[model samples]
Target chain A: MAGAPNQASLVERLVFRGTRIAALVILVVLVAPMIVIVPLSLTSGTLLIYPLPGLSGRWYEEFFTERLWVQATWNSVLIAVPTTVLATTLGTFAALGLNRLRSRLVPAVAVFLITPLIVPVIIYAVSAFYFYSRLGIVGTYPGLIFGHTALAIPFVVVTVNATLKNFDANLLRAALVLGATPRQAFARVTLPLILPGVLSGGLFAFITSFDELILTLFVASPEQRTLPRQLWSGVQETINPTIAAAAVVLMLVSVLVMLLAEWLRRQGRRIQGKQ
Target chain B: MERADRRRELVGWLLVAPSLLFMAFFFAVPIGAFLLRSVDNTDLVGAMPRTMAEIGGWNGQDLPDESLFMALGEDFTALPDITAAASLGRRLNHNLTGYRSLVMRTFTGLRRHEGPLGREALIAIDKRWSDPAHWRVIQQERSWLTPLYLLASLDLERGPEGIRTIPPERRLFVDLLVRTAWISIAVTLLCLVLGFPLAYVMASSGPRLSSWMLVLVLLPFWTSLLVRTTAWIVLLQRNGLVNQVLERLGLIDAPLTLIYNRLGVYIAMTHVLLPFLVLPLYSVMKGVGGDLTRAAAGLGAPPSTVFRRVYLPQVMPGIIAGCSLVFVLALGYYITPALVGGPRDQMIAHFIAYFTSTSVNWGMAASLAGILLLMVVVLYAALARLVGLDRLKAR
Candidate 1:
């Protein structure tokens, strides 16, 4: 009996060790690509062939000095900022209206709002080209901006609506009973509660517009080329290390913004749990 | 008293009006025009109404009468400017390949024609038109509205008489649509398989562990898609870290083919879309209580059985929602596959972009768009019937 119990303990120990090793292996497997690129991006050679010769920052320098890259980055920001603002504003109001409605209509309204998300972006882009051409808005800032906003609004609606789920209706009732108008109560009570979700949604909107390629392909002319558009053309036209450097910069910016959004979401979750 | 309530309802509509109107004008109107363009017949007959009318009585099966030919020559010569001829040439080009250059070259020749309307003028312009086949095409397509372009877009075309399937070699977009659906379904399944466990851990673990895990999941969301795809290329290439490690361990004799393949496409796409699955699943799982599983276990059930009967049923709605969301997203993926996947692995979005930009075939592009839209609507309806999206939301 003593021998049997000891053997069972030994087997349990081996199993535990194996499970830990498996988890570590999976983590390494997931992270290996990010690890490899850090070294590859620092290679001294002109070409990106493997067994990179040495180390240098010339590609990064070239990225900064290039006029087209600079202009494209500026254009991406110009398109993304206005799109983020419009999507957030419209999405917030839309969420408010949606929340006020009865539960029966909420799902239908959500499906309607999410149509842009569910549809293939390529189809929307093709249609937009014809639509904008007829309206004489094609290849213009307004056209691209509106298109981007439409793409981003669903993100805002989903996030803001999620945040509103935890909101207590009694507060609105309390505010109304205390002589606060509906607008004032919402501004002071509801807006503060949902601001984090709004911010995260806006961040998502910004990312969507900044990285958008298909719609920009249809709506943007050469003069209005955004960073993704420029990157796309560069990839199609030639193989260059400049794109690697641009990728690095874009990755860094997006990671930072995403981290901020994650932090906000965590904060919102904690607040809701408390309420 | 009732006016106040009416005023509030009016304000509610006013608040939502701008977005609704914007969608109608920009989104709805464009889709309508694209649908119209599928059957729009602005070419051939529209370009030469008088000529079409004069030749209307001539049966196209036989060679057109000399009188009809003379009428065409006279109409071609009477054009006050070269622009009309160019427009007619442009209209004909859509029906036949290599016709645009032919039209342009003929327009230049007609500009130099000095003779009266006769066989000499027609023969001088281009000998290609001496064949009756060209005249037959011209007479057949002399209608203001055509089902030809629309039919051709579906890999079916209307010739001199009736509609027929385009040749197998040219039957491209339909296959692409099927391929796109398969890829999207595969990605969605991959997301579900990988994300379910992670989301389960996040929802079931202690707050501290879940928070840390959540941060790791969200980290990839912040990174740019271009960077993520480029990172995969770097890692999966012949002598990259993955191969280096594999070689060191003697896992294989040589670096395996990985990047620029379907496997690479799946890897990069699954990585990018995994977070989409995790988020929705996490939200739904957070609302599920652990007690249901515990109670089932307490009632003489094993751990796996408890998970299956209790937890799995509860989480099915989230699974459906997350899968549909990820599937819809993966179907439209363009840049990732273009960069990572081989030529044959390219999806429908790539072709749509090709037709819109490089090929400049708006009719074909719109028809493809229509097909894609139909596919999404069908998938959404199926999903709605299966899970009913309302139940998928966080309670």
Candidate 2:
């Protein structure tokens, strides 16, 4: 569109139109399944086919009342809460350290810090199974938390690290120069500036651990089953309407998390603007 | 002042120390320890210490001496329980087929020894022991470490002669690794094909339309992977909406096989990974100002020439970054393939899971993990060289 419009020949116009059509088709393919599934989830028919026999909240009610589903929801929260806390704390520190260290080794150190994200999670799941089995913690909440936290930290690190890139180090030094203690300067200046990053990063950590299935498959016992693991088993059993309802519930949770993250990101950009 | 500077840097180190230690212990070391299993012989060496010590002096040409047989008998008796013996048997079975039953039969035979457990007595319990191949397996795994697992991962084995490929029927991991790479490359290309234009559109559109498109992409990105996978399952089933719609449109009387196959995997994986490409490529395209293209057009370059010469080069980093991300992510993918794919569609990750869980074969799991890890690192190194690491981080 920004090119010399008058000089555009018929062939160029055709190519451009062709590309736009392709893009539209791909966009529909990308988003269509998500849209179609929501209505399917609301359909009362036991079958997952289209043209629902009726409309009802029966499946959603079953999702709430089901023993396995309820247990999984609780387990997901149990693991995700501690995972978010531990990851956000440790990851925030990693971000803060790497941001301020002013060392030549930062890139390599950062890479090491984020390798958990880089490596395929299957590797993590298998290794974690071996590691936790030895520690006698594999089936326990603490074990799943440990595994999820390790995996989730990289997400936090990447998110907070990106935010830290926008952070001005002079602000910290300014506070310090004004005779506030190092701790005081950090508490007053640095933490607030990066809180949005930390909160959003925590949301990412929560969703990551929340949606995680592979590690839970290898690490968690039936007693420790999480939402994704349950969905996996449910789908493995059959693609019943109840499974679709479960998926919708899971999707809604992630959507809420995403909106919250987007909000925090906007607030972060606002802070950046004020700076 | 230098002391204060030192103190400040020390604070940075202190801040970083906990996570580094945590990650090293929980992440790196565990992975290292598990991967070490690919070469570890603690199972063998620990199970038969007496036999390992006694067998050291025996010549490879003959069956080991009566003393070695007595030592093996003693080692079998010395095991903590039948399960320990069984575990040892399983490990030996990996080295050579049927060693599990042989070891188990010998362990039971030793328990009911009629007299002195000499070479003759052991041979009577299991006639196969008279053969030198079984003894060779013991001698091979006598060390603190062995390459049996790692070699097996590539479908090679250590014959007395040297390393050679296993029988074609037994050869699996090599093909598995290749298939994983193939599938990942296909998915990456698909993402690039589907995403490049969408990303271009998102970058060039008006703010309102652009944000809407961005939401469409980000919605899937933010949605649960399992949910999207489940959607595909519902939508692609034979009696599902896709087939029904196609039929209503008179496309086919019979519903085409869609789910639980390669086509389904590609469709689901491309949809899942497409955003990863589009988001990064979109940012890169947005950052690529139109001035250069406009200038090139004004200077009489054709649209195609201007796009190729001016626009494409500027967006190369984004393309490289996005493609590499999608490809790498696809390499170790498990869930979508496991659910939507046929047995043939399962990737190396599926086997990694299988070996870890189903067969309880840590050696195979670790070996496969090690090989998969090597592939990822090599691909990452090659791609990092292309666009550098920071562009990946920016994505």
Best by TM-score: 2
TM-score of chain A for the candidates in order shown: 0.87, 0.94
Expressed as tens digits, the lDDT of each residue in B125-149 for candidate 1 is 7776677767766776777777665
Q: Which ten residues in a row have the lowest lDDT in candidate 1 chain B?
A: B386-395
Native-structure RMSD, model 2:
2.7
Q: After the best TM-score superposition of candidate 1, give how far the Cα of residue B383 lies from its true spot, in angstroms.
A: 1.1
lDDT of each candidate versus the true structure = 0.77, 0.90
Query: What i-RMS does each candidate reach, in Å?
Result: 3.1, 1.2
What is the RMSD of candidate 1? 4.4
Candidate 1, residue A40: Cα displacement in angstroms equals 4.1
Tens digit of per-residue lDDT, candidate 2, span A1-275: 65556547777889888888898998898989988988888887889887988898998999889999999999999999999999999999988887768678888888988898789999999899998999999999999998988988888989999998899888988898899997799799888888999999999999999999998998999999998999999999978888888898898898899889989999999987786
- How much is the lDDT of residue B80 in candidate 1? 61
Candidate 1 accuracy as lDDT: 0.77
The residue-by-residue lDDT of candidate 1 on A229-266, one tens digit each, is 88777765655567777777777778778888878988
